[model samples]
Target chain A: MTGPRYTPLVAALPATVPFIGPETQERARGRPFAARLGANENVFGPSPRAIEAMAQAAREVWMYGDPENHDLRHALAAHHGVGADNVVVGEGIDGLLGYLVRMLIAPGDAVATSEGAYPTFNFHVAGFGGVLHKVPYKGDHEDPDALITRAAETGAKLIYLANPDNPMGSWHDAATIARMIKAVPEGALLVLDEAYVDLAPAGTAPAITPEDPRVIRMRTFSKGYGMAGARVGYAIGSAPLIEGFNKIRNHFGMSRIAQAGALAALADQAWLAEVQTRVAEARDRIAAIVRANGLAPLPSATNFVTIDCGGDGAFARRVLAELIARDIFVRMPFVAPHDRCIRVSAGRAEDLAAFEAALPAALDAARRSAG
Target chain B: MTGPRYTPLVAALPATVPFIGPETQERARGRPFAARLGANENVFGPSPRAIEAMAQAAREVWMYGDPENHDLRHALAAHHGVGADNVVVGEGIDGLLGYLVRMLIAPGDAVATSEGAYPTFNFHVAGFGGVLHKVPYKGDHEDPDALITRAAETGAKLIYLANPDNPMGSWHDAATIARMIKAVPEGALLVLDEAYVDLAPAGTAPAITPEDPRVIRMRTFSKGYGMAGARVGYAIGSAPLIEGFNKIRNHFGMSRIAQAGALAALADQAWLAEVQTRVAEARDRIAAIVRANGLAPLPSATNFVTIDCGGDGAFARRVLAELIARDIFVRMPFVAPHDRCIRVSAGRAEDLAAFEAALPAALDAARRSAG
Candidate 1:
């Protein structure tokens, strides 16, 4: 009873994850999923070179990773044509987002994001006691303009926009996003998440210089690079904004093997291009599967395809449950309207085939249950 | 441009490190260090089995780690003879410390720690806007009584005590630490950091129940397990206290390879025992080297020895500089009194041989420079 006491904010927060991981769900169900298309992880797997690098570095795990993340940052900077000072690497986009929110948000401060955007960002905003004003998605795509307008009205300090976005696989081209950044309003900073930029067509990411103080672009190794388990992500921005992460980040949080793996991943552009090709093929195949099921597939610039369930939220929920019951792991958005769609990630041919084979049965079961 | 704003406390804080990493210094020096004994990493390395497990898991890095860290927690709980609920695994002790501080310390709240102790803990407290109160070391050891008294005076919400402590490898027996834990002021929680305990002699850690609500004990594989680069650490406390971390922890931050590595490391008790034996031998060797050079080596229970240069902080610093100049990477405490001792970690036979050959020349060079 004599332990240190927690602050009111932390004490008030509940221990929760916005989404239950498939691993946890599998344990509960006593069976692993036949097809894991949820979480948007690259089931095509990382490049052989990245796997080799990680394996080689495994023996060197006794030495802490470079706190500066020097080599990886330099490689990333060179890849993006920026100075090393313009970058800071972290655990993942989720982890970087948490640090960004910590640096910029205080208790009861306002933050703006799409209502059905990445939930992890919202989790962090709430973790720091920030008051969030959520703008709903417009036409299945994140409405950057509405987000900026709300941020302006609320004097919000942070705005999140994921280009080639998640859950919906929608995108606004670079020029449009750059203009949105210009309209973010004074005192508010934009967090332009480009987690899926590698999967998007050229020009999807804005051409803003890394020195731009108005926005911090978040990129990750989890998707296109196929290293989600390595947990490497970085933020590119002005020197001050990037350096600001040092204020509260876990300085030695990164795994040495992960840094090596990510460095290898960044160096292997040919492999990245190949993965992009595979992801595109997978995206098309996913869309084909949705069409074969008589559902409308949204146009996707990212690695996933969002399929309209041709019904309401309830129907989508039933389809998702049926898919889970059929051992095909897939997910849907949390909010209304968007919840009418099921999101499936790009995966290996084998994994997608499992999904392809299981869908009709899952839909049939859902229909039977609905009846 | 404007964005969601930072809280006042976050805005007021400066980004800083308790210690500059050797890699950072290397970047400045434009070369890698010949010996990396500065960061208290176990150059002895992790178990072969651990290396193999990590390597095996490398290709599977495409999948996110189990967010619950269930398997690792279960293994840790079994290792400690406690229930699985009593343990929470994290990125490292550094990661757990940040979460604990965030949970307990808020703006203007008081927290106490030994002066010149682990600086990362202090960094986290400051990051959360907590007011810090320092208790000077007594006879180069963390004085638990003084810490308790300061906690009572400051009405501190948290107190940090590192046993088999860092910077200076001094420790109080379990009975003493248990007594101190009992005497902590009401509402002040004691954090018992036993990061070095596994390398210490028997009876170094307190005999506390895992379900004890008054204290939380943290351990790491970074030291004795020789996997610092793997970034795995755990905390043992009441279920409720352990659960509090989930409210804000990076759920998927752990590397899949790391989990496997740690699990393998934990299972290989014989490797740990062998390493402990080696560490003890190295400790004695370091002490003898110090004595041969006419310096004083403090008795140490941890993997490193702290040697007093028999002069002021400047003289000790000069010795450190000379060592680095000779390609021997060693470190020292950052504050007065404690800064009089240069700390050297246990290294391999060849590394120790290099340290042995460099010691006299470095000392002589340091003397010349001082003159």
Candidate 2:
């Protein structure tokens, strides 16, 4: 028998995994990595209170989670000093991105983002048959002016900008971001993704007003709160815009454990401060390790540090392979210039210790392989 | 300035909630539900092993869930005697329905289901601009023949049928389902939603093969497995069709705790059997309670029973209202003919006792209001 009739758009799309997960690599290697510093997971883990909350929630999973996400919304609103109407929650940033793309981008609609930004965002755009107009990173950071220019030129209805960007761990200052917000073309909605802002320095985030029509910002518990496995993310915007999510979102999609865990994590600011300190220390240690190997570590406001290998893209690829062979799990940027650097997450003491011991031999092997 | 520019279809679609959760109702009444039987949740709860697994997974929340869903897929495959490629896991049946509709039904494409079938399915159809053709239920059962006929007539690309159906608590046996599958119009795929099948009789489900290309059947942990808040649902279909989900789904949407819990729940068949026995006893009790109030109890293969109130839709609605006012959460169908009933789930002993105590007054109040 023939199969179901897939829509033309879906049929044309390839089954691509946006990110090759570390578990997949582990399976391929037939064993687990000694250093799990890839995927950018917080090695510090979630707050003890958050874990306790999730355990309590696990006992009550016989009932469905509130479809309205009411408790979490009110809690998040109170946390942000905005009305509950300004917030909407989803499975994670990935899930929210899909819903946002579906609501705003009809087939062939124009969307804009950096060429080497989050691949998950690009995956969503292509899934909805949206036309993507991308600007390359200026040096290692996302070029805000170029994105605004591309949006204006191509009439892109949605412009995606990740402050304290991923892959390169670079960010624009608050004033630069404010300028970018003003420069957004009239019809385009800027998606200010602040998934990492909780770990960034003060003033890294611009002040947001719920009624400000220019942008909808997203934040997640995945990076800073260290609950990536919990899969909680939320968007803040005008009431009407937030309410529009009701038209297309999967109601009752959130896991009850996730909601309870995120609420507890958000409440424990002291644990977050401890994580920030740990991440900073790890980042410093990572940079020193890179320097000892004669590689340059890029400036980072994010938890991960991107180290530039003293060679071309192929040399960086060899270095990455050598690292993987040495049981170190790390990733590099996908495109050129940026591809010359490999990214590493802030791991705990033993995990980082493994990385430090592996780097020298991995680098020497990469150099010999290139020669 | 205007907020984000929504696509014309989304702009036209009203912001609607398909189901009004009991939590929402409780908040409105500023109280808790004494007897919650509306949502058909498995009040008997999940396996103790599942709870322990979730608690353990909670401590590992620093890492993201395996995006590939490899371990869970293999487990489900082994349980079903199918290859891992035949199963695709999702947030829930609701989330899977959304993705299925997106993959198969392009804008303005035709789809078919019962007129009073699941509203969430209809919501997904409307969200994607699929034109839904509906046929009324025949003798309180979803008419599979009529659904197939309508699909053929309207060139519907997808036909939805829920065995052991919701609201009506009715089901078609295996042979009837097989005949319906053979009758599915060429180029149209049949959607067999067996969300409640685990609680049905021995011969209720048709035997399925991984190579079956004519239909995709969905199952969930929400009803019989007693883990509604886990948000785990899966579809068994041809490998190619199942793979198509990778194109649009939130790859990492499944929560880590949920994955671990569902895997544990699936392994403990004894727990599921115990829940089934408990549900059957509760259903019988519910039926007896309804008969005591002079209402007719419909025969059910599902986890809930629908009681005919011996009056019209409006009368049944009044009865439902009185029940809710008494802090007993019950629901009635929305459309006529079928709407003469109020549906209740098989709650535990205390919850059912609360239901038994509250019904007589609710019936009297409804009659008094009608008089």
Candidate 3:
């Protein structure tokens, strides 16, 4: 019997996930990964103070979180020198992206992004029935010029750019991004995803004023703050755009414990500094390991290092599969040219040692499989 | 100075919150609420096991929660004697409702619900640009037959009914609900929100099978489990309908700590039983208090009691405002007839004591102001 009918757009969309989580793989393989570095999660963990705050808040879960996300929003506003009205906190950047797309994109609207950028963003665009125009990467990094050109050509309403781009771990400096922001076509909102900016080198974030209505900057506690599972992310934009989120967002969606943890995490700058330093060390170790294994590690400004596999997309896939099979979780790019490399996140010394040990065998297995 | 343009529907929609949280009122009044009975939160709190589980999961927040929500979904399936595919969990019932509406309601699609049922449900339908047909409540209860008739007349894509309804603590029996389910119009889905069913009397819940494609039941950890702040809710329905959530849901949205807490909370059925008992006792106390103040307390089968103010909506409005001014947070229904009552949630003894202490003064203030 026929059940309720899905909306035309929803009916046309595929039932797919952007990324198969490492846990799903672990379940399928009947074992946990030896070194969990694939998803780029910060293994150093959130600040001890943040964990303590969450534990304390656990006993208070009977009450729904502040619908306004009052304290956290004010703190973030003060941190960024923006008014609280200029900041909007959500379940995550992914959730915010969905809301943003729904707010702007009617069916058949145009959106633009790099060919193989964050799939979750593309997923949102598609979910909202936005027609996506994909621009190719220039060398190892997303080409802002090409993306802007494509947006102008297609009359795209939104242009998504992730600073310190994922998959390749490449970044554009602040001045470069500032120039790109200037070049953005009129009427197109620039969505600057700064999920990795906390792990990027200085000057990676442009000094855009919060009242600039042309761009919305997304930041998350998921990466450098080491609270991905806490699912807290905020967007900084003009007051009108930020206020628009309240129209359609699940206003009471934030988890109370997550809010408390994020507040504490934001307050603990010393812990963040320590984690950054450790991440740097881990990156160096990962690079050395990759070089020793006959792969060239790409220059990275984020928590993960992308290494050129010295082959094509198929070869990189095989390498990734080999690593997964060897109990060393890793991932690679999704499109051509960029897929010639595999991405590995910075981890603890023991985790890196496990990765180091598994790399050679994984490479051997991949080579054997290719032959 | 123009920003990105919003879709026509979003442009037309007002940025409004359905409920003004007690916290926002506290901020405005510069004082905390003396007794929080406005929102139907279980002040008794979650199970000790849930708190411990959340605390334990706090340290693991660095990792993203499983995209599949495998363990929790499977556990819920086993608990309900349904297959895992019959269940889909989300950020909360609010989040899930948004997704469900988006999935089913195209712009201009017809939806049906009681005029002042759950405003949040109405909010979602409006957010999705659905045309909503409102039927008046039959007496104090949601008229299932009227809702069904309206759904058929309007060819509604979805019909929403909350068993053990909110704002007015009234409910219909299982046999009536079963008849309503059978009478749901073809191509229309019935959304059964059971947020308070855990506290309802035995035989109140209809014995609907999970495989029933015509209806989807929403359940949450926010009420009986005392985890409103945790933000976990699930929908149980036919596998096909449940699988549709994967097409548009924020796959990585669930909070890790919340997931762990809900799992532990579900396992501790003893805790749920005790909560039900406490809530029933609290409801009785609230009714006694209401009757003592020369108001009529409606018979309740939920966690709150709606007390008729023995006047008009205007009088009830004054009573509600007086309670708020007195730092006793209580809410009233939004429509006529029903609006002649104030809804107070079941709270701890101390909280209720504060409500009892303030009610006479609030009534006095209302009477004097009306004069």
Candidate 4:
């Protein structure tokens, strides 16, 4: 309390974490969860090649990573069918989003996001002192039209939207999203986050022209590639937008081992395809578990399924708590309406088995606790 | 640019890199540098045990690092003889400095530093729109008294100092620094960057308690520990100061492999001592090389030698270019006085041998070119 004072923005901010890690929850509960099916992490793990690359590159961690991120960017460009100038690799999509907000938003500037879209994004905007204007989700999905309208109304300089969204597991098809991008008001940049695009059906992602400067697309090795811990993410846009990152990014931020692992992850299309299939199967299994528990599961294009608890947010919160108490790690949305649903990530068969066995007793316990 | 327009701050920033890496320079030159002495990277590499631990942990890259950084922080606290609450691990000293600047500096807020202090610190201050007030170095060393006076005069929120300083490689003893700390004006936070402290002699570092609230001490594995690519650094201060970072930090930004690597790096004190000895030897060798070429080498407590070219900044610039032409990578200070000398890092025997062979030739070339 006697420390030299913080700047006004930092002093005014509450010491809040964007998400409670499952580890913290487990420690508080005095035991590890039987089913680690929260946080949307890929329980299936990374590709064998990626793991081997990381292991091999680990020996060379003594040498600082290439500050330029030259090799990874080149490899990513070839894999994605774009020029190297179109890509900028970073710690993760979360880290990249932080930098983007820092670059584009100043104090009191308006930024637009969907309500309950991604708390992490909102956290970044708040961190940079931007005024966040959230558009409510329309029918359990990110409403691009609403976001565009809000951006226009607020004169927002930045807008964030995640296709194949989290929590609600909703998406907009390519043409619909493309139209939305075209409709973005002047001076507004659309941050189209496609973190879950690999798990989505064909045409779920817009055909973004890398030459187009109006929108930047973000992707990661965290989801379908199953290397979340590797912390490799990239943003793709026009040369100018990509170049701007050089002005302020941690020059040597990328880890050599991570760059190597992500390069292998990008090169292995077969592994990604297999991961997508496994993710789809796990999603269906989770849906089946929800049905067995007499709850409805939303159709999902991502690695997680959102189950309606058949009541308000309070009931969903109780269910989440009961699941945690029963050694099942899961989460619920934060906003009302969406908060009525509990989210479960795809995990291994054993983890799913644990979830399936725990659901009934957990639900009953939640009901008793609520009463 | 037809792209989404950037905010005025971002648009005003030139797309610039702080330094062109040796690799990039080599590529442009169409040949590798015979002596890799620039950028201050440890050519001696990291502890073999640390490398082994990193490689071992690479298999577990599927799991995100402990966001609490519990194990690493506790280990660092024990190593530094402080409580865990006093330490906060981050990407690097560079990264932590960015957060510190963001926390204490607002647009148009004044900050003070030595005229030729670490450019990265100045970069961070400028990035946040802080007005930089520099105190010139007295006798090629950072003048703490002058810096304190400048801070008081300008009502600066933050002041930066690098002990066992960079560029000119000068240092102040611990007692002098403690005295300077006591003299610091009220409301100004002194940032002591001790990145090179491990390579310096005993008693060269101030003995301020880690719980001291007025000063934030930064340390890194990027220097003597030889894990620059790992991107691991930490700051020691009061609990409140440490907690302030939780307000806006990238919660999941750290790499699993990096944490494991840095943890191992910190645990190996024997390896650190050995590296310290080796760095000292290399510094002596570099000084010998400079002496052989008839240039004066400044006494340094850091891991590099600053060799006076015995002329003006223009002459030193010519010498640097001549060395670059001769495929020896080295750098010079960006500001006057200090810029009159060229900095060369301590490296392996082979790297020093390369420097030995090229120096005479480079000097001759520089003289001819100047004429």
C-alpha lDDT of residue B157 in model 2: 94
Models 1 onward score TM values of 0.98, 0.99, 0.99, 0.97
* Model 1 misplaced stretches (Cα beyond 4 Å): B1-6
Query: Clashing residue pairs in candidate 2, if any?
Result: none
How do the residues A33-111 of candidate 2 rate in per-residue lDDT, one tens digit apiece?
Answer: 9999989899799999999999999999999999999999999999999999999999999999999999899889999
Best by DockQ: 3
Candidate 3 per-residue C-alpha lDDT over B44-91 given as tens digits, one digit per residue, 9 for 90 to 100: 999999999999999999999998999999999999888999999998
Displacement of residue A231 (Cα, Å) in model 1 is 0.5
Off by over 4 Å in 2: none
- Model 4 misplacement above 4 A: A1-3, B1-5
Report the lDDT tens digits of candidate 2 across residue range B1-371: 66578899999999998999999999999999998899999988899999999999999989999998899999999999999999999999999999999999988999999989999999999999999999999999999999999998999999999998988999999999999988888888888999999999999999886787889999999999999999999999999999999999999999989999999999999999999999999999999999988999999999999999989999999999999999899898999998999999999999999999999999999999998
Cα RMSD to the true fold for all candidates: 1.3, 0.8, 0.8, 1.8
**Which scores higher on DockQ, 1 or 2?**
2
For every prediction, compared with the true complex, DockQ reads 0.77, 0.86, 0.89, 0.61
| lDDT per model vs. reference | 0.90, 0.93, 0.93, 0.87
| lDDT by residue (tens digit), candidate 3, A1-371 | 47898999999999989999998999999999999999999999999999999999999999999999999999999888889999999999999999999999988999999988999999999999999999999998999999999999999999999999998899999999999888878888999999999999999999958888779999999999999999999999999999999999999999999999999999999999999999999999999999999899999989999999999988889989988888999888899999899999999999999999888988888889898
Chain A superposition TM-score per model: 0.98, 0.99, 0.99, 0.98
Clashing pairs in 4: A64-B229, A213-B3
Q: Which ten residues in a row have the lowest lDDT in candidate 1 chain B?
A: B1-10
By the DockQ metric, which is better: model 2 or model 4? 2
Error of 1 at A113 (Å): 0.9
Number of the candidate with higher lDDT, 1 or 2: 2
Better of 2 and 4 by lDDT: 2
Q: iRMSD per model? A: 1.6, 0.8, 0.7, 1.9
